[model samples]
Target: MEDLAQMTLDLTDRRLLSELQRKGRIFNSDLAEKVNLSASACHRRVQRLEAEGYINEYVALLDARKMGVPATIFVEITLSTQADEVLEAFEKAVQRIPDVLECHLTAGAADYILKVVAEDTEDFARIHRQYLTRLPGVAKMQSSFALRTVFKTTALPV
Candidate 1:
């Protein structure tokens, strides 16, 4: 295996990645034809791409509304201190919260930001009382409910 930093994506590889991003379950024969490569070559390239960490795990994108958890809440959390133990404890505890979709260590006013989902505003309040308030070292916390999602995507440009 070669160093990932040194590996460059050519046109064919880029095409393969782009195609895979849009249609992950695309058949190898169909993918090869789209990318203008032989089936064996395409298979090898896909394997190499995965091995090199160009491709991460594939997953099904679910509908939040259908799942009954459509409400989106963005939480800005300010810790009491920037101590390593406080940060570590908060990060570890936040990961255990199933309602929290994403937790990011951030810059600006807040030490951390959390993207959370719930059935509704009441549900969020329940989550806040049940989970958020109990998080270690939380000095100040602010939450904003999303009225609507103007744009959202999992795909990144290849």
Candidate 2:
């Protein structure tokens, strides 16, 4: 019963989201037309979705390679200890580094996962030394460079 309800909600949300994903800069009237909803109804639905924490934020996706951040790296970090103070300190420090765009506390072989972008190898090296390696509680670090992004989508496959 719950699954069916979820599916129904997901279907409607996906229809709305797919339209927005294709054109963030598009007007709400156009969006309503595409989604087959009255403008006011569509507006209310979008507002409700935002209020309920479904639509986090609309962002302008950048062309990273053209923007000088030609290198994309996934960094795996293992901390020395899982003490609250150590974890909080490490998290706070990582947030200060602009290159560390995304960070996730993990459950597998690694403690944290970082999505980092840098101008070049030298820039990444400097970030590694000054930011990641020196971060409190850091015991081990590994990085995976992205050769290409085959698919990156903000819209959920609802």
Candidate 3:
């Protein structure tokens, strides 16, 4: 396997990635045509990209409202301590909560920021009571609910 750090993308590879980012389910032949490569060659490049960890797993982006989870909350968490063990314990505990879609450690007033989803405000209350409050070393937690999502995308610019 090629080292990811040493892997440089050429023009053709960039084209291939751009097409794939737009439509992950596009046919190999179609992708090849778009990138001006043979089907086999395109497939090989895709495989190599995956093997080199350039492309992670592909997933279907679901509609939260349709999936019965419409509420989106961003929670800022301040830990009681910045100790390694406290951070580790908090991260491990937060991972067990299914409602938490993303958690990021930040350098600001808050130690961590969490993106969470729920069916509604009532459900969010339950999640807060059941999970958020139970996280270890939590000194403070402030939550902001998103009224609407202006724009969201999973595709990364190549």
Candidate 4:
């Protein structure tokens, strides 16, 4: 398979991806119209894009507030050591935590950064007591709550 970095995206491919990112559920015919391609051609291009791993998966973006998980918390975790086994164990544990939306191994002061969501601070406290505290090799942890989200988007510029 061609590497994504090596693959060249033509203008039409970019347009198709941009449109799909904005509206994953858009009909093939509608997408064709928007990208100025015949329906059959558009279908083939979309299929090729997916096969090439340009479009990984389609998902419906949900409202966090409506889902009863409005609170957004960013946690910076510093493990006791940078040992490979400790890092692997910590990552494995985090993957099982449903509330942890994302986890990143990072450089700088913290070994890892985590994005967590919950119903509220109290719920987060429960999660902390249950999951975060039990994570392996944690030397320090700091969390910050987002008060408001002024801007948020799932679409990527293709």
Query: What is the C-alpha lDDT profile of model 2 across 4-78, one tens digit per residue?
Result: 443235555678878777777788898888878899988988887776666778889988888899899999999
Q: 1-158 in candidate 4: lDDT tens per residue?
A: 55767568999999999999999999999999999999999999999999888899999889899999999999999999999999999999999999999999998999999999999999999999999999999999999999999898877777
Ranking by lDDT: 1, 4, 3, 2
Model 3's alpha-carbon lDDT is: 0.93
Ten contiguous residues minimizing lDDT sum, candidate 4? 1-10
Clashes of 1: 0
Indicate the TM-score of model 3: 0.95
Model 1 pairs in collision: none
TM-score of each model, in listed order: 0.95, 0.88, 0.95, 0.95
For every candidate, C-alpha RMSD to the true structure in Å: 1.9, 3.0, 1.9, 1.5
User: Which candidate, 1 or 3, has the higher lDDT?
Assistant: 1
User: Which candidate should be chosen as best, given lDDT against the real structure?
Assistant: 1
Q: What does the lDDT read for residue 81 in candidate 2? A: 92
Query: Each model's number of backbone clashes?
Result: 0, 0, 0, 0
Segments in model 4 whose C-alpha atoms lie over 4 Å from true places: none
Query: For candidate 1, which ten residues in a row score worst on lDDT?
Result: 1-10
lDDT of 1 by residue, 1-158 (tens): 56668579999999999999999999999999999999999999999999888998898989999999999999999999999999999999999999999999999999999999999999999999999999999999999999999999887897
Ranking by TM-score: 4, 1, 3, 2
Task: Go through the candidates in order and give each one's C-alpha lDDT.
Answer: 0.96, 0.85, 0.93, 0.95
lDDT of 3 at 74: 100
